[model samples]
Target: MNLTTKVNVTEEAEKLEKVLFSQKFWIDLGTTSLRIVLILIFAVLAVKIGKVIIRRLFRLKLKGPIRKSERRENTLLKLLENTISYVVYFSAILAVLTEFDIDVKGLLAGAGVLGLAVGFGAQSLVKDVITGFFILFEDQFSVGDYVKIGIAEGYVEEIGLRTTKIKSFTGEIYILPNGSIIQVVNYSLENSLAIVDVSIPFDVEVNRTEKLIEYYLTIVSQDKADFINKPKLIGAHDFTETEMIVRIIAETKPMRHYDCARLIGIGLKDYLEKEGITIPYPNLVTKSLTDV
Candidate 1:
């Protein structure tokens, strides 16, 4: 090669080597990586600390005499925890972008415009948020409530700003958008009724059956703390050719009716058997095909 060409090539190689082997460049890269790692760690710690604080604050409120509804407080606690996580992670991402020498302000500005444009097409999302806010404000339902929304019946697992989560008894989870919940039937808001029906032979006197049921209900009320008051024996709710139906109704704590009803049925059955009253059971008689 010519001398001038060789000199130019050597100068380019030296410049490339200097750029690659520079200690300052490696130090700056390491520093930037460390800062990004620290930023992420700080974000994670902030979320955890924020959650802890929220839980402690709610616990303190529960200890006070003028405490608010526990369900509402639990819902709010979860919402705040989620919000803190989202905000911290978002900030951490932006901080990391900044460390990479990207202009965060310009990115955010562009994002804002894009978000606005996207908002026009996301009407259902906006509706969901607005409806969720009203659901909280109006106290329609809260976490742990047994509710029926539309065709879904389950316990509320979470109430978020955009959606609600319900866990059914069969272990199915239903995630519903807030805007679609047109009606809600909350079974947890009031006491439940435990109704038990006892059928007796027509030969038994109605007055005697009523007296026995009344005594049995009084005993049940005394034994069980779930009963709000003594159960009433409503005489002769129905009648058939061979049997008379007697209805007993008890007021119980919410969601306690099913178990309470079963308990009452068991106790009453035992009591009636001891008193010589027999419950009738269907008798099946089978005949051979030839006999038929």
Candidate 2:
């Protein structure tokens, strides 16, 4: 090789190395990193602010004269907060990818196709979301409501967009998809009726017993917080050979029917016994023949 040619080639190689290790290159890279960090910080702040705003708006709505339930308000607030967070985070991620020179449009197009495929495959999931929305919108049931859906009967612990968590009386938590809930029996919507039957010996005076029970029920209604109205003694309900059953019905607060019934039964028994009324019990007659 000639001397001048070799020198020129060496200078070109030095120029290339200088450009690669230039301060401008590091500065540009640092600027990009700072922009990504700023984007993430803004996204987080936006989500937080959005959530606060949503909660405040819902709180205002709750305090208004329209009078919405606490559970429904909380459910709506949470759903809005989640949606806001998701949107903000997604936008921030897209902006970061753009800073890195990634093709966000192409990525979004591919994601759209993939999402369509997933949506087709997950029809039940879509149904669940749709049903959940209607459940919230229509006020079908709320958190802490005692409900019976299919074979699952429990207090609703959590209601989400896709699933509901119910805690049974026996301490079992049932996670049920919203789409699976077709028929729901919400026991908390109205007052519950408590029916109690007291058995008395056939010899007892029916008219006097009924009057006494009615009086006692009036007293019970006054003392019990659960009672919505005074209980009524429904005369004689069932007749057996040994005893006659008198049925008492009481209107009580929701979920308090069982306790109200139990208290009424005990009070009736004590009162009846005090008034010299005999409560009948079944007798087992055993005949033994030893003479044969």
Candidate 3:
């Protein structure tokens, strides 16, 4: 309303408008955005290139006469890939912060102090790291190994500094912290046993049944590459009121027992059908009320 107040308000509006329309403001924003984008791009490229390099290095090592264990190499490759990703992304974040005019040195110093203060309370984290180290060092289990830790049973997908990844047969992934893995049952370290039970009606001649199975066992492993040796017929294992159970044992490559067992069951069923040896099935009969 007053002349002096109107002039002051107009001056403040003009100054605000000028600042908003300044070329330097838009230019600075664009520059900072472009720098951040470039930093992120470089980080992604670094991770990809690092992974390729590591895989190539492993390939070269495998080609050598004195080669390392493939399982162990796979574990190391995964660990290295994760490490490179973490480092590259962390560096990229720092570069982006610098673009925003954040003091990198001061932030890092403060983080260091904070980390130290928090370390005492982060016992599980420390334990996880230490346990992971010992696991790798002792070669308890490697990536691709079939293992059971606690209730999680599957192939090891990755072993990291703080956690282990297990991919189950059902497509579920279990992420277990390293500190909690107290007992591990690794099935990949040795051969596996596959047991198949064939049930025959008690009326069938036991000697003839055994002979047929013996002949079948001789050729069972011939087509199966995973089988370490021919399957053996362990003879009549048990007897039921209607049928007799014969057992067959197979020695197969580690983690391949499942396939081998299934193949054995199918082949034996087919063989018995072709030989006219009928597997018993319960018979049902219905009587009319007049007959009863």
Candidate 4:
């Protein structure tokens, strides 16, 4: 109740106010913010440098005498880069949170539980990732490979842990989950058989036609490097009332079958016409009832 007591109490209150609103408090906040910014910058740099190192290492591995397919190398490089980025960014986030005195252990525990719950709901995603890993490891198909999956056929543009991107011949892009790929037909894996069917008039001599085709095939094999082997005349494939279907089979380079078949067809037509071989056309005969 005395004046001295009142002055001493007032001095204690002023000291408390100064401590609460001091420049040091603001400076500490600013320093924390700067640390966060620096951490973010380091994270970005880590990702960039990690990517560069990954690329160089893979490049050297690919160039070694052991010899790896380009597609396999590319898939691994992308997978490594993505994994490095995720890990580095996650660590950087934790570091930044620690700078602000946040409880990282509790956050990670919560995240783990949340991830478990999400995992139960996202079984398909996990399946897709597992399937993708198998696809890469087994070398089933790679980027730039022309493949047919179910009804979708196209050149593979990208293969990720969850999905695959394919660009079709008609310029349509298809994104399919890796788990959904049950069967894959890779057209680039081996030589393709070019089958060309030629229809001739039934009246034409079959034996002479066969010999003529075999002779022409020998010429084609010599001229076109795409042809892996000489064409084989498989005799008559089918018989119609007006014509006989002859089948020609040729082994050509992968993906060149269509072109080779087309060229063979043209050449056959030209040769048949030059040799006066008749190609059958349907002829319709109509009789009037009145005349009958």
Candidate 5:
């Protein structure tokens, strides 16, 4: 055959193959749908059976190092479940295409290009997912943990693959991308310190106010079970024009900072009032026109 005739024949064959792949009928739908159904059944069976058997073995309480190891295993199980589901669904798609007798060779070559585009677009997204996985596996934080991560401080509400949900003290929900978290301050990991400031009028008897605070600090330290660390009456934090700022600080358990601060404030108030110590208020002194 002449070169021109051979080129024409190859073009026609390519066009025909395109047309065949694009043609979809009701019969094709039925076949593909059946395959999807079967694959879905297999995925469900795998999850149910795998969880029952694998998780059952972990049912008994583990102790010491074993308990910590078990938690890491749980993280792996969650990752496995996610990976397995996607794999099963992908296998179903390939099977469905094969049923139509479509050429998978060219599809694979096309897939490489498509996958390259997708991979580049999803780099940060994948990083978020991978970092989130490590966060969980390492037990960095858990739901209900009060943490400060990347300037967003709050209690962790939920932990997902790509993001973590934190409810801030201002009642705002912060959805933090895992990849963006550089510093993770897991306050839940250790005891928290509560710091409270109470300024009194400078003209008031400083000795009396100091004594009252000292008395109440003792009472608070002894009464509150949450007070793991004793309260410190930090004497005079600052001397302002209007008042002397007296700060009282206490260290308590993970979630007890708020309550600890409140208790100190209340106890100090009642004691100081009984002792006739004045809590400072902003003063508006008006200079008379005569003085001017």
Candidate 6:
């Protein structure tokens, strides 16, 4: 027999056996009725079992350690678990009602209409889903990626079916609906530029300065761990009556460009001083009337 029939039969047989036992048969019958009343209890137990399974699976996901935004994946999974439990519990109630010969056809139709009405009232909800789909497929940004959307710039905190969460550098959490995300600048996707502008004084011999810089740059570039590209002393960028400006450029690895730049700055000054090169300082000249 099925679970329902077996349960009923067991309770019935237990009651009959107890009733035939002694003078307290009526009390025993009442206790047996309470035992059969635990049908809902079993359904609740099943829900608990499902939750345990969900927890175990989620813990395994944590161990796998896939990078995602906002630590929100855990919350989303919990919400799904709750939804499943409620849905299954409602289905069980409907099954029990069917056993009592209740017609739920009208109720189902009413629920459908109500659902449609609610859906229409929440247009943003629909927009959220549509936009979220496009965002993921278009690869707008992934978890742990530094990005800027509109006025907000930070590491992507989370990407959900409805909204995106951003954690700002200033420690503010910004929640943006995917539908509202019009412009996204993802900084983590490509290489970064670390440009250093080195200024030389007018009195310093320009050729000596340039050659020394180029020589040092070649050496720096030859140092495998320190350099990225062979440093190029580009054409003179600016010429003023007092001093000239030269721009040095190098292509370096992402995020480490700053490291290369810092090294260049510190090393450049020391190298120039050791070569007896002078850094120009601002000098103002005044003419006296008598001298003129």
Cα RMSD for candidates in order: 8.8, 9.0, 10.6, 9.7, 11.4, 13.6
| Model 4: residue 193 alpha-carbon error in angstroms | 1.5
Sort by TM-score, best first: what order?
2, 1, 4, 3, 5, 6
Tens digits of lDDT, candidate 2, 122-160 = 999999999998898778898889888988988999988
Our tally of clashes for model 6 stands at: 2
Off by over 4 Å in 6: 1-115, 221-228, 280-292
Cα lDDT of model 6 by residue, 136-173, tens digit: 65566777777889988889888887999999978999
* Clash count per candidate: 0, 0, 0, 0, 0, 2
- RMSD (CA, Å), candidate 5 to true, equals 11.4
- Candidate 3 Cα errors over 4 Å, as ranges: 1-69, 73-118, 280-292
TM-score of each: 0.72, 0.77, 0.60, 0.69, 0.55, 0.55
Indicate which candidate wins on lDDT. 3
Determine which window of 10 residues in candidate 2 has minimal summed lDDT. 283-292
In candidate 4, what are the lDDT values of residues 105-187, reduced to their tens digit?
99999999998998899999989999998898778898888788988888999988799999999999999999999988888
Better of 2 and 4 by lDDT: 2
For candidate 4, the lDDT comes to 0.82
Q: lDDT per model, in order? A: 0.82, 0.83, 0.83, 0.82, 0.75, 0.72
Compared with the true structure, what per-residue lDDT tens digits does model 3 show for residues 228-266?
899888777788888888777877888788788888788
Candidate achieving higher TM-score, 1 or 2: 2
Clashes of 2: 0
